[model samples]
Target: MASEILAQLQAQKLLIVNPRRKNGLIIYKKYYAEFAGPGAIVGGQFDCDAIAVLPVGKISLIVPQTPEERRQAYKMRRQWVKLTKQITDNPIPAERAQVILNQFEHWFDAQTVENLPDEAFALLVGVLPQTITKVRNNGLF
Candidate 1:
């Protein structure tokens, strides 16, 4: 019965929305993990350890994309990652943490910043989860 419902939705190109669902899958490689979000394509990763999805919060739209869309998404994602790397590449951990926090706070509202998972944010910023906790906490981490 559930399968029938899902099939119907999928056929209609409707993505399942888990209000508590995450926006991407984490492709865990040997040493680190990368994220595959909307418009991004993840494939040929047979040797990777595993692809773990986030606990549940953001919406991950896993679907096919046109070649043009894929190209655009790839460019945007690459740029975002590169910028994050630049920020995290800072020698001083304190400065790196502050920059990431400010960026997120600007991209998203303060509440959304608080809602983001600390571990994911830490991974993106090349910081430790504890650092994220300290930086993102006021109401909580």
Candidate 2:
């Protein structure tokens, strides 16, 4: 599932930066990457506890390891809030945001490759378009 998501993100030209260990054990610590238009910066991390997505600027959607990790994530969330605000404050066009979200959905879908039930597949088909609309309207990049 992760590989599929990784492929989609890569296909979209999003940079994927994974932390490496000397033992060649891709420590599932943090996997982060980002995609930007002509002049944008995107990056993120997947750690022992969470998967973080920082598309533009520093705003992030962090999926933590466990309920306990939420406390630590709170600190990271503050940083993301500051970064996201900066990205949104920029003079980027609205259309650009849509492009980013479209890529994000592709990535999100990839993340669920393993256990995607038939019902979920239908739900995704129905929900994705609306979700994209909401993201576009909200200018969430």
The prediction achieving the highest TM-score against the true structure is: 1
lDDT of 2 by residue, 1-98 (tens): 34443343334422222212111011121422222221121223322232322222222222344545544444444443354344345354343344
Estimate the Cα RMSD of every predicted model relative to the unseen true structure: 7.4, 14.3
Off by over 4 Å in 1: 1-50, 55-62, 137-141
Instruction: Tell me each candidate's TM-score.
Output: 0.60, 0.24
Residue 75 of model 1 has an lDDT of 62
Error of 2 at 84 (Å): 2.5
Report the error of model 1 at residue 8, Å: 19
The lDDT values for all models are 0.52, 0.33
lDDT of 1 by residue, 88-123 (tens): 689876566678778767654577667767776667
Candidate 2, TM-score vs. the true structure?
Answer: 0.24
